[model samples]
Target: MQPPSKTTPFSLPVDSDHKATKFRPFTISPPHMRAFHLAWISLFSCFFSTFAIPPLLPAIRRDLHLTAADVGRAGVASFAGSIFSRLAMGPICDLLGPCAATAAFSLLTAPAVLSASFMSNSTSFIVIRFLIGFSLANFVACQFWMSSMFSNNVVAVANGVAAGWASVGSGFTQLVMPLIYSFLINTVNLSSSTAWRVAFFVPAFFQTVTALMVLAFGQDLPDGKYKRSSNITGQISKENAFTILLNGLKNYRGWILGLTYGFCFGVELTTDNILAQYFYERFNLDIKTAGAIAASFGLANIVSRPAGGLVSDEMGRRFGMRGRLWSLWVVQTAAGLLCFLLGRSNSLWGSVLVVCCFSFFVQAASGLTFGVVPFVSKRSLGVISGMTGSGGTIGAVITQLLLFSGSSGNYMSTQTSISLMGILMVFCTLPLTLLYFPHSGGMFCRPNYPPTHQQHYDHLLQCQ
Candidate 1:
């Protein structure tokens, strides 16, 4: 046997497969921390690429003469693409490992982002947005990678931070794209249209670069890249890809979690698509100002989502899965209330404050939702993650269609639609209260249920 890799000597807590128990954000050594950084950064680039257009939508709308219907359609299309791609990405991760799957996906999607500059009509804009949205599938890989690299005890924090940082790309692009647009118009002497188009090249380039880096340097498991026959510790290698996916699909918990994710992550996606435009139109703010405010919503993910995971993990340690469920329900319910208030605020500063709070809770709810995911089924982690991820996109699609779609013939005002969406979120949280696991129970279920045989087996594995 070959000698152990140099990075394997760290004293951090590790499990049977040597998956890390502690989450060190600054750590860059491979198989754990290195994978953490690469996973988040790779996902970050994809988020950036997918959302780069939203901040510039005002300009695109004017240039393309897009109606509100067209705009809503484009938003739906983007999430729709992500829904399908994320579903596919789960099994892909199971087959090739997240590293290879992510790299290949990024390379394939970057061209679509580049092609954004060519959008000349409503149809083309919607189609291009749809294609660019495929990059969000990297989210599944990011979460799967974190779960694979860290033990269950610290996995929430790992998943939270990785997803949180990756999501910052949405906020980062919101803040940066407008500045780029302004620079091109004011300094580079390009027209507004040309400048926005040129800005696409920036995210596309970064997406390509990050993809190449992951492909070259990223590790799939603690030991090495994934192999079909290799039995990596903490992972189920006996199951084929199809079997893995079917197992995940058959688990009712995955469906419940998917619905929970829809209201949290799905609402977040819809907000990202429309918030800048909302601020611009409602408050009469310039693109830069509106983008900046909207940026606060996405940027909140940096802290808010991780905080959710931290809380979930802490609760799990203290109160078991019931704690995780309570935290998810409480946070999500508050998010819905805040979301309702966000639409009702008449003053600009009030609106901003409510949105910031809403961001914290909604994103935190996302973190909490995923905190429960790894426990759903380790054997089918990828499929369950995919289902939940796709559920988020599906939620966005439904929200966009039901509320924001101007095709309603008698379109409700944007504010009213937003308020209505909040009510829906409140109703959605009800499902979380009903989810029960034989091992740890749920929100209203008995917390002291006797451990099932599988639970005992899992506990033994954790101890070993």
Candidate 2:
């Protein structure tokens, strides 16, 4: 069977016959819905395979006999591996094309994730986990795919839904992995040790399956369904990859936005891993309870992050470029304050409530950051995506170092450190609203881009 026609697969109406079509839930039809649907799965799988470790931390620590700091280091190592690798994802995705890149990450990472089933020692387990981080580069590809399919006016909403939905896996895994592990033990009669190892089979299988499905069924462009021309163009030159990388990193806005993302998404990555343990220690709860509470942090991303993007989209209409910037600052600043308040809370439920609030703003900030990312430069979306995506991992690496370095990392010490990190997040982001980008479409004092769409492939295919 052939792929569907890409000329606005969704039977939705277009405002201009010569411009890109806009899709909203109310007006969405087939097959654009098909592309949008699968794109989120690509992103969901990237994180599902990469972060599958944290939700299983209790089993991981018991099987490996690791200390708390050792667990923290293991999580840090995963982020450390991703910091630079994610930067490479953009150019690589552009070079390989998003469809190929998405499928490739799934196929490539499956073995590494599945290998956890046979690990004999902490060293091997940690090494395998670190390698899994490489799959996170798929995130750049997923975002770039959305940018290609949607109009600029609704891109933020599209990105937020895609990212927000993908992020749910973190929390869902937290709530579910324990159940999966238990099912393996009780139903299959596997030993507790073996159950943990066998549990990884789930992520490995899902990862591979999702990849094949996307490659087989997904479309790369809107004007033509399942076209391979862009994929062929991606392979034409290795030199093109380096050029894209350099151009992406050179954008000062990418750097600032990346840093801001470091505070939100990066912190979320670290928090996802640590939250389970933190709750276990701070509230003296069992691993199951702690993991469930931690899952709540990620669960909020489904709605909160989209709210951020929707807010940015609305702000852009009212305030232009500054609106996106303003939304980011406000959400992030609120998140910073929530972090401090969370640290000071005296009761367990009190802290958990604050954490839910914190989760909302932090995840929303992530959506807002990406809302602005595409506007940085159309020619370099892949590069910018990688650069900004890496920022979150970079932030996780730094946060882990600073938070765990000087302290024994007890509950109080951890809270105090996070509060300080919150202060730092605000200070770091303040200069961004004042900065500007001119090349993409702005002035020195203000950065703004008029939202416009193309009827045919342009920014994505113009990679020469």
Model 1 regions lying over 4 Å from their true place: 1-11, 228-238, 447-455, 459-464
Question: Model 2, stretches more than 4 Å misplaced?
Answer: 1-10, 14-20, 25-31, 225-239, 405-412, 439-464
lDDT of 1 by residue, 298-320 (tens): 99999999999999999999999
The local distance difference test score of each candidate is 0.89, 0.76
Prediction 1 global C-alpha lDDT: 0.89
Worst 10 residues of 1 by lDDT: 455-464
Model 2 lowest lDDT segment of ten: 439-448
21-136: candidate 2 lDDT, tens digit per residue: 55564333544556677877777876777767776777777878877667766777788878777787787666666788788877988899899888777787768878888877
Residue pairs with backbone atoms closer than 3 Å in model 1 (clashes): none
Q: Candidate 2: lDDT over CA atoms?
A: 0.76
Q: Largest lDDT belongs to which candidate? A: 1
